[model samples]
Target chain A: MAFDLTLLTGSGFWNPFFWLISIVVALILIYIIYAFGEKGYKRGTQQVKPFISGNPEPSKAGVHVRAGNLYWGYMDALKVYYAGLVPIHSGILTDYLLWLFSVAAILFVLVVLL
Target chain B: MITDFLLHHTPALLVAVPLLGAFLTPIIGRISPIVRKIWVMGTMTLTSAIAVLLVYLVYTRGTFVYVFGALTPGLAIPPDSGGIPIRIIFTVDPMGAFMDLIVAVVGFCVILYSLSGDEKRTGLHYFYTLFLLLITSVLGMVSTGDLFNFFVFIEISSLASAGLVAFSVEQGRAVEAGLKYFMISTMGGIFLLFAIGILYGQYNALNIAMIAERMQFTSLDKIALVLMVVALAMKCGAVPLHFWTPDAYSLAPSTITAMLVVVSQASLYGLFRFVFTLYNLTLNYVTIGWVIIILGVLSMVIGVTMAIPQKDVKRLMAYHAVSQTGYMLLGVGVGLAVLGNQAALDTYGFIAIEGGLFHIINHALYKGLLFLTAGAIIYRIGTRDLNKMGGLGHSMKYTMIFFMIGALAIAGIPPFNGFASKLLIYESVYLFNPLLAIIAMVVSILTLASFVKVFHSIFMGPTLPEYSKVREAPPAMLIGMGILAVLIIAFGFFPQLVVDSLVAPAAHALINQGSYISAILGGA
Candidate 1:
């Protein structure tokens, strides 16, 4: 047996229940588009210069926002995330020893118990 | 089935076909470029087809083993007790076949991609030769019944992968990255050898099943197991040990880089094998699980944070590779933590492990697609800088579409494959520990933000003045991305299919580790 089609798409077309719902959905989509286009037409010609209250929007060209500028607010909120991770230094010999110790402790407990 | 000829030989051929092709490729290449290309594609396709066939056979006939040199089990047909099977073997019992499928599918796509890109100057033939050898080694590592063979295959994969990393000899940074890769991998290899030495001394047997039978969880074995875990962790690019990954991944050609990500994932398979097979933590899972979970959390937090600041898109993806791996570990770790807790194991443990394994498949799909798309961008615009890319959505519309799909998938947005797997992980792990799940959710959101940055910088904004003349990626690259995109959407919508066929078998193999051992030893 191949695909039942009903399970994939819906029940048979004349099943009436879903057919009604489908028509209603299609009508609503068209209505929404029509309503949105009408409103857009009104707004499109209202002669509004780019509204400049105080801070103007940047030019739509050539500005590549760096990570610092992009997340300045968040950066300010979390000032010292690196402090917690500093011990994970790539160059630290002691950090290596600590990792070894932790791994050892965990394995020792597992071997004893399991 | 026992009487069938072809079925009996399929397991051994899975490894042998590619191993033979790896050597045969160079000889064919000397005849003509077309010959080598055709042969390479043919051999990979055949291997992939065989993988599919083997999976089908397993589904039908159950678990099977292929003793090397035709070492028949028992006195007559099936091997009996005390019958010293001197031959090496290939055993496929669900998990091995699944990993084979991953390697073949991903490797095939990568080979197809290499055909599309500009061939490197030095030894294109050797590149494909090593490429096939790498595929063979990965398959062998996943399928070998013997532990020593696993190490041999690892060395093969490591050497071929390093050579591929430095395949572009003109680029000095590629050479440097390859050297770094070799150093770190060799350290991992040494550690692996040390563990093997300890295990061999203890059991006097190298077959995985034989070793598992004799292993008694002694203090020495415990120390060796921990060392093995650490070694495999480094190989898998776990946090704090993942520094070599980003540089090596960024330096290689994108196709090779994508393959390298999957290669690291194979190490996770090794870890899974050890955790479940070598050391069944059905009794004492909490402490071990907590250790893995904590490492996963650290990796999740650190990898994405590092990615956020990376300028090179490949390096950024490489870091995300590390981060996504943390997500997988979180799922598997949560599962491990609650294994013996009957109520927890059935509900949360299974869900978390399944989620993690599902993410493994999903990561290979979207991440592979993303790296390929990044390569497409570089191939077209000739740069890896996210800053220099702007309004690429207009010039490289196809690439943009594919990149957006991959980005959305990786970010764990709903209606994408990433979200489905991640949602499973979140719910299951939340049951295990809500704080861990919340941290995972935060990492998901951060991943979304990072990909959004990528999209805005590369696809939106004005076209860079210099790149106004840039073209879309070649058709073959788009085909590669298109295949992954389809898979991403398909799996997202009908996830139960993947869960049933792929994830269930893999998780089952992990849980039923005894089945793995017994199957290799000619039992179940």
Candidate 2:
């Protein structure tokens, strides 16, 4: 039944069944490639060991990237933006209330004056 | 014999069953735990059945109204003051029925999750009671045709939800969160009440239909509009006014946080009702519409940026909730902006609102699923810190799968319900402004990037020594999350059917003010 359905947007349309077909084709091709490969592959073995330009892999704890470090470069680049943004969320109830009233006042002026 | 009566009084019964059940929950709890669980689930099941039947009836029968205190239940019997009905009314169009369906599905799933998740906590009876009451208020908010009744429902929702937010006595910050929510809600309520009073003063009516029919967009009306806009926007977590959202959402128990998503969208429904129905033709569409668009843009940009840096898993999801709300606002606001121009309205406006309405249901499903998964993780590890989690996919395989489904869906990846709706939004809203659409796409990328970080942190790497013993979430929780996951997948596959059957009629019902007013007052 889904094969007959097409979701129309204002600019274009989407057919999920087509996407499904593509994925199925892609998977079958990959499987065919896998069928011809050597059967000696083993997981978590020396075959899978990392050789990053002849440098040894770090310990597991060091190797496993923490959530903090996952986007460290991104965060560092945006520190100036976040410097002005994160402090807006001061975690103080009074400051939150102040922000609410300030927004309403600005809207009131905009709506009334415009 | 019984079916006809229920079919007739379905709207009233939908709200009444839950309100009565909520009060009776504590008494039933004294009997036995199993009986209480059965009672809560049964109440939600019946309410959901009624909601579905009402939605089906609306699609078939067109819009209808039921007067509470009238001599004839269907007719709007006038008081001695002549021709204007003074009783409370539940006038449900496809728009209201659409909202009711969202409330019903998410409400049942949340109740299912709460049963297993909070069974061991103290004062569990109160938790069920408050949850049922919150369901009652949301149903009432969406269905009521009276402005004053809408305000009453908002107050009831605020009281019940604030209590539930503070119900997690295990969390130290809950009381602070609840207190701040109460203060913020009370302030919003004052503005809403003031707006209602002004409208009642001008039109001599409390029913939204009557007032809408008699609307005069005067200076006073503009004042009331500003008050109502700001109040409802704050309630729904639009930017600069979204300060209370993260605190309230992250501190509530995970199941309750899931339900709170629907509640905030109820406020959004109220905002749409006010702008589209009450001030449809006469008001300045361009100015008011652009105002909403700006609010939505700011909310989308700010909410996601704040979400990317959070270490608390629940808090990050809470920020995403705010971010997602912006998409709905943007789509509908585009519809409103071009409402005056017939050419533009036909070109992209209707699809824009349909996209918004579609996203409302989609967000409720995936966001609810995501929160439940987070709750499952927290229930297992007794912590909310992402820095402290790892290798959960080894043991809690089902929850990991459910979380992946939700995370990908929320990021607007293809083959999920979120992409279907967001696609509608992006393609349609671009016709209005390319910059806004670009901003939305950039937000989607950031959402995906952040979620990749989350998945890698919690599910990848070797199993942590401390968490190696953590098992799967209980069966009831799994079933609850599974309900939403199946829905997300099905909606993904059937976007055309969903849009034609549900979203289009809802957008039509919202934009057609005459029909809403006529359902209560008289002729088309």
Candidate 3:
């Protein structure tokens, strides 16, 4: 009884057993809702195809977005941010060492003084 | 009787057996490649068993030391008898034993995964040799009580890992990545050696316990501390010092990439061992702790943000590895920050560090599984570009499930091991400072978003025409992945069991510096 398997995060406890059970119940509920609708829907047809601004995608490939295109807007939003962050990962060994030694230099002063 | 002998000699055997097996691999390969594979697997099984038994002993019997060779590292030397004690000590507290378990599990699984690589490659004999040696080095690193030997193990691991990273030499970039990893590691190793020399000059001792026993925390000591911190921080892929990580991890054989995750944690082990065990109360805890937290926060934010837009699956995972490493740093770093105030320490400090430590093991399993699944895809479909991968879930169902388990877990999703640790970290670090906790949570969200992109890009969508005939990963590879997958789920379902049984005791051992010192110096 002492070490019952419930993780006590400082503020609360997480019992995965309860979480798992709730998940199963929620899943059952989802299945029931799903079962009620979409019974007439068919697979491998235009029913599954994407509706674009006006027309259906021409082919399956047109609908399947490539991974390189997945995070376009996210990258767009973070252009300035990545500009600053990505350049530091210039893949140059010198710059890498510069970061390493630069950190060592700063910490050298801080550790000594503080 | 054999158990008794093993109990006494586990530390030495843990390092030595694999080292010997590594040297024997090429010779065994001469006999037959199959024979060499058997020999390497046999050696690892025995080593993993030794690790498990070591963990059991350390857990039940409390912390202990194993000494080998003639002269101790400037400790308890009979003054008149003369020779400098060149001895090595392996001290296995709960923490060391915890690290041993991590390497053991990851090492065994990676060896299994490497068999798939071995079938396609020619220099597999050399591959197994370096692999075993890397395992030996990490095991020795975690278990060693002496600083010099720890450095020795670090050097050996870096060399072996550099070789493995360049194993696919046909690709020019693998060579490039290996060179980068090698040079960075060499520089970090040099800094570490200089720091060790400084300590040796100041204290005349190479044993961690011996130095901790007599730490003066002078200015010279601070210089040495910064050097060691930077070196180990670089080794573990802390943000600014983490440039080598994505390159090395992305380019390494997937098996080696997985093992590299554990290897970085060994450095994390070294970093924690230094701060908590060596410089616990003698130094300015708050300043150093805050320093670690900042590094962690940067790693979390920068690493994840870089990950989101990456098209390369492994490189993307590599960035996330950098991000995940931040959580460990944040969690334990919080614990370190709170060390000055006994009330704060008692209130949430231990929980925070435990969160960090727990994350280490969790990260190893899921991250390793993710890498292996990436390898499996590369094996069948022959590309690491997530854009090129699709419908893999239809063909490679097991790998897909493993990837899901790993992805969900890494995202800190519930009913998984990552969530448990993240929750612990979130709640505890919130007590220390709310902003850091919020940053950690935001990082987790980004992590989930990035992994979602990965899942959609790589495994979702229709089975592309080119990959329609792609078979599942081989039995050995699936078994390798299955081991981690099972553990991930088991750990998820029973996070508390793992924490109570494995994590809390390790945290206790880490913070109780007096015990570590006394265990080594015989109550000085």
Candidate 4:
């Protein structure tokens, strides 16, 4: 039987054949593009070398970006939120247990009062 | 006849077979490492097959109770006793079968991955033994109908997982992580035991269905509910209480980390069982539901934000595990919020729960794949520092593809399992509250952004001189990851199949508690 999920709503997402056809069509289209595009490609030449703003390529190690520096702006903008969150994940067992207890206490109050 | 026996005794055997394998693993290992490896594989294969059979039996035969050491499965309550199940009971409802399927599938894959990934490690027998025992405990936790039995299983799982976490003695950090995990797990265990004790003291019964039938929702029951939910939320790595999750997940051997993800999901299963079945409609669900929802929102926001800044690849994935867990909580929490109101529940609650439940399986598959891939990178290059990993795509083509599949799946990209479930959550939760759904969408975007950073840092850059000699991961690891990747794609494309076969029956069994109680009481 098909998976209906009618209890959740009238929505159902069960057309495997549709997905199969779509994937086949997409792959064929991509294969056609690649087959046509390969005629202009050159191999084993200076033209194949990576260009960095028309400057000579630096050592790979020097140019490789590290994970720590990848999202500097995002971190800077969320500085205050991180300051609050990062400290709370303090890697201390005592603090972790404390948080567990605090949440329990808060939940207790809420469940009882409401 | 044999099939009948196995079907009748599936629940007990599911737990017992693994426990037996665990005890025999070290003895078998002493004979020969190869023999031990074969034995472990055989054991897990059998266990997984039995789990599948149990799910089939549950779906076809309906809910049933298996009383340990009893004359008959139906003899849960002693004739002398006042309708209380004195013996330990194993309730193989659809929900339990659902969790068993997850534990079995993931546990089998982890064992396959571990065969090669941890081949050279010392005390290999102990590792395999603890792994089997951990699986046993998880199965027990999901299947047991007795609250005290659940507590016992929780303790076993905690100890076994902690041992596995500390397996790499060379890494002092692994030992530290194990210690922290043990301490927090112990605290959670104590709270769990205390809550069980409260219920036992008040109702004089330890069986979940029994106590649920007699639920008074008294002051003590409220306290017990708080303690139980808090402890389980902590165990499952819910936010505000999820500090130990990253440390333990990052430090464990990659295969064990994959299994630990399932371990946490078992805890999540327990949380849902307590909320939906044990408490049912007796408690102030709206209040409890909002509390859970708030915890989920916190976990989602904090987990992804923290993951974005992490330099350690495994640690980043661990935080994402926490974030993915939040989606399950949010989906189920929405269901709980509208529990008693039939109109609201019929309108959106069931879908919300389905979304959460669907996410559970999807998360397990994709997260397990991600950890295995991370392990592969570490196995080849000897480091999890993303900065050090560059141009691995050149050497490890299959690994790159697997990682991409996992990355896209976890990021909720379409044509992946994560997207299917997240769609259900978004569309349904939006009806409940627009703001919640919007936050969920924002979290999904951030998850994608964080993983993009991971992908670019690890695979997209120029080939580094340091990793020039690094080769592809071994075939066994690839096969393990391949299984999960294939399943992820299949589930993504055919979500309706998964929903019909697994999620719907499981969600219905969970939300319908009367059937659970009646299975034991014989419709009394």
Candidate 5:
């Protein structure tokens, strides 16, 4: 009887299940901060030293993975699809309205019977 | 008597009021700079009030027919049975009224934003003039009862918006983008004209209801449907036909770009009016659903993929606009697919349709806010490039917060307005096709990732030396974006408010075809 009551009510907002989640979240956050602090302390002690150039002088590591080139490769692939949509200059405006008229007229006939 | 007049005149007023305002703007602009401000503000405010009144009246009194110059735009309301409706007409249904309310609200915001822009670039008087005309035409397209009237309004809007889009073309690329938009849109308009000619040949009447009455389906019907599908697909920026959208939207002034997003939506409205009201919704017509769904799925997949790589923020937002459109179309396509199924499927269809309609409203809010926020950023930083931007959050805190809110809402994150509507769409589509649902979910996840990237790159990073001098957006732009952000949260937190007030009525309008027919064809 107690189990059944707990199962149903526990699913609601005040469930004991939430306390478990909160404790887990707090522990994870604490762990992350501690790890960051340890990394900083190690760096200060020169235990994890920065890389040096061939001349034995320190220098910043270069960033790679160019973003612009990747985008160009993708665009090149889509060129075929773009080619098919070549804009045709047709100047017939009245014909479009006529199409609208006939289609709307047909539907009106059928739906009005409802 | 007043109710009767409204029933008969609301549609015309929807168009006429804005057109009149557009016309009066030049004269008003001559009086004072403040006069231009007052005219635009007052006209939009009045239109907004009228839209609310029109919506209320539609709910209470059912459908009302407004004849232009006493001419029914479509079917003739004869002195007796079997008489022709001689005048051009405007039909006010619950759906049309809802559209009016949307256009009015967004149109008002655009006008307000325009006020803060550089008057020389905007050409204050002409800007408001074109803006009002655009509003009028959009309202007219939605509310007009005649097929021809819809075309006229479409042209008015297309032409005026094209001008607005290129308004900032002191730069050559902007001009090129505008010209591209014009050429493509002209092609669409021409195709539409051909389709209309075929329709007119079949049925002499130009009024929508009358054509519905008089048209007898033939081989021409199929041809006309195909033509209209192509034409409207181009207009709505469906996957294969959507090329012009990004360039045009990216090149346009930010406020104008926001307004232009609604162009595709209005085209969707036109598509819906065509499909549900003009074509047969029976299962016998499986071809229509297949075509629409295929296009929708393509748009969903392609639009998001394209958005992923875009470095320009406005261009990225433009691609997202296409992807968001895919959501609306997906819902609509699913609804069409399940039209003739039993009550169970019908309920799902209604859910999908209502979800789609509701998403339109949600998209307008967040997307508009997103663009306005983008505008605010551009206003400060003088560029639309994301790579050029970093750590803007420190300088433009409020704008960043609001932009994040909008971005999250658009990504359909839970507890936001986008999520609520998208949830309904996902559930309903899943009921119909699990595969389609999977695709939609994949798209949603990708959308979320893309926006997260935007937020991180633009706001969360360390301050860039270049942007350290930048300040927050002006008060007016901030206020506009802030209002939309609040609406996003409010609607997100309490979806029932929207579901009850807007979605329910719209769903009823679509589902209860009998009510529409009876009201228009004259009582039972």
Candidate 6:
């Protein structure tokens, strides 16, 4: 019943106990770091003021980013790719069927040829 | 003695109990809504118990064939038949039992969640009935040994799920989604039937084992294989043919959406069954395997990319579901590619296949939990739009915690169930080809990034003035999420226990197709 997949060289990921021990050791290290950190900070004071290159702080609602605006750079870089791919998911029934038929045809040809 | 009786009749009872409950739901609803709720929960609990027992029986006793209407379960083929199985048989192998276990556990949790989550909707009786029937169809699809029976169950599940998808008629988009789902499923069903006809014409058999035993691997068989694989992959939401997935998944009622995830996994189970058991290594393993691998890669990349720009929470999660499916396909595809090479298989191929099998269960648990959490949020907030919500963590603390758990689990963070299986795939698949493993790791990072976006938009930031009065989801919904949450933690911590008892055995059953064919034809 012991399911162990021994990888190359005798090391493997079969023992959950190893993971448990690692987790405990990591937690202890984190606790030690937290204990050594600065404390006695006060909220709602100039000391805790927001810093943004010395610019005035914006309203909370305005600063909260929306999901659509979060990944702008990634989307912009992949613009051409999205232009080709997004239209395929055009939410049309005919396009869906067309894709199914096209994939079937391609797979059939590949299987037969190979 | 009672265990013997139940074990003997497990296959029939697995399908029958839900079917009977489905029919009786409307009648019981007239008596009292409370009675109806109790009835649905009681039925699913009973069915879940039976599924566990069936998996136990299959794992302990090996593969057994239960022939319908026969005096004994072992009489799969007629004595006078010329080595052909004429009777419809229910083949309970380890793989089938594993799928049954998934359907049972997820289906039961969904039913429990719906009790409170859907309490205010009209036509409660019909909803419960279709839900039960959906469960029955999924169970039938996985357990049946006959190809034609599998088709019948596929149709039933398709219709039931489409009906549930359209349940929210108030949203015109739901109706549109249901229509698209029905049309796609109808096309899939037709192709499935045509493939079955081709096999029946060539081998004169509808039983999967019979056709597999007599397979000639002719040109016609090649055509059938293409048709079957494409149709099942389309049904399971593989990219290029997965347009129906996001629409159907996003539009369905949340509980039903959870069930739809399981439905897609069932179709995936069918795809693997056909490839590994029916075709075995007879076909061009490298070509077909690469085809699957390429499909997996596209799904993984495109699924995550599409999810990034989505504003609707459910639609975003739907896309992630597709991406997660790619991992399963990738792991198993690598296994298939090296199927005929015993040296490669012994070294890393079986591990890859186990990784895929392990991901199947993990995906079902985490994805199902995520959907239920989305439902709980929508129940309180009245909107699935991410931009309109913030700071739900203040009022709905438990829901926030559950969502965090599901989010972490789905993103493949360590110590969760997703990480264990994914780690197996990433390590072992590098041996096959480093690029595939690299792409998989990149997809994992993207998945985590997307979920972080979701967590920040919905649960972080200042509390929205509109949702200040929003309360936590009801106890029943919390209970449903709790079941999956506890399981996620258990499977995460005890990965070896699950791999040993379930995934490894299931992977072995899939690779060893000789035993499957011999079990049916050995007696004859």
Which candidate comes out best when scored by DockQ? Answer: 3
Question: Each candidate: what lDDT?
Answer: 0.77, 0.91, 0.90, 0.90, 0.73, 0.90
Give the lDDT ranking, best first: 2, 4, 6, 3, 1, 5
For model 2, residues B338-416, the per-residue Cα lDDT tens digits are 9999999999989889998999999999999999999999999998888888888888999999999999999999899
TM-score of 3: 0.96
Query: Candidate 1, residues B114-195: lDDT per residue as tens digits?
Result: 7776453458778888888888888888877777888998898899999989887888988877887787778678878888
Per-residue lDDT, model 5, residue A79, is 69
Worst 10 residues of 5 chain B by lDDT: B278-287
- What stretches of model 1 exceed 4 Å from their correct place? A1-69, A83-114, B1-6, B71-85, B118-121, B522-524
Candidate 1 chain B has its poorest 10 consecutive residues by lDDT at B72-81
Residue lDDT tens for model 1, A1-114:
221212111111112235347768989999989887644345546444356585675554536453334655665565588556543545333444455446546655665545
- State fnat for each of the candidate structures: 0.07, 0.61, 0.78, 0.61, 0.00, 0.50
Is candidate 1 or 2 superior in lDDT? 2
Measured against the native two-chain assembly using Cα atoms, what DockQ does each of the candidate structures obtain, in the order listed? 0.13, 0.60, 0.69, 0.52, 0.06, 0.43
Error of 6 at B502 (Å): 0.5
lDDT of 1: 0.77
Model 5 alpha-carbon miss at residue B55, Å: 1.6
Query: What lDDT would candidate 6 get against the real structure?
Result: 0.90
Model 5 lDDT on a 0 to 1 scale: 0.73
Top candidate when judged by lDDT against the true structure: 2
For model 4, what is the error of residue B99's alpha carbon versus the real structure, in angstroms, after optimal superposition? 0.2
Q: Give the C-alpha miss distance for residue B84 in model 3, angstroms.
A: 9.3
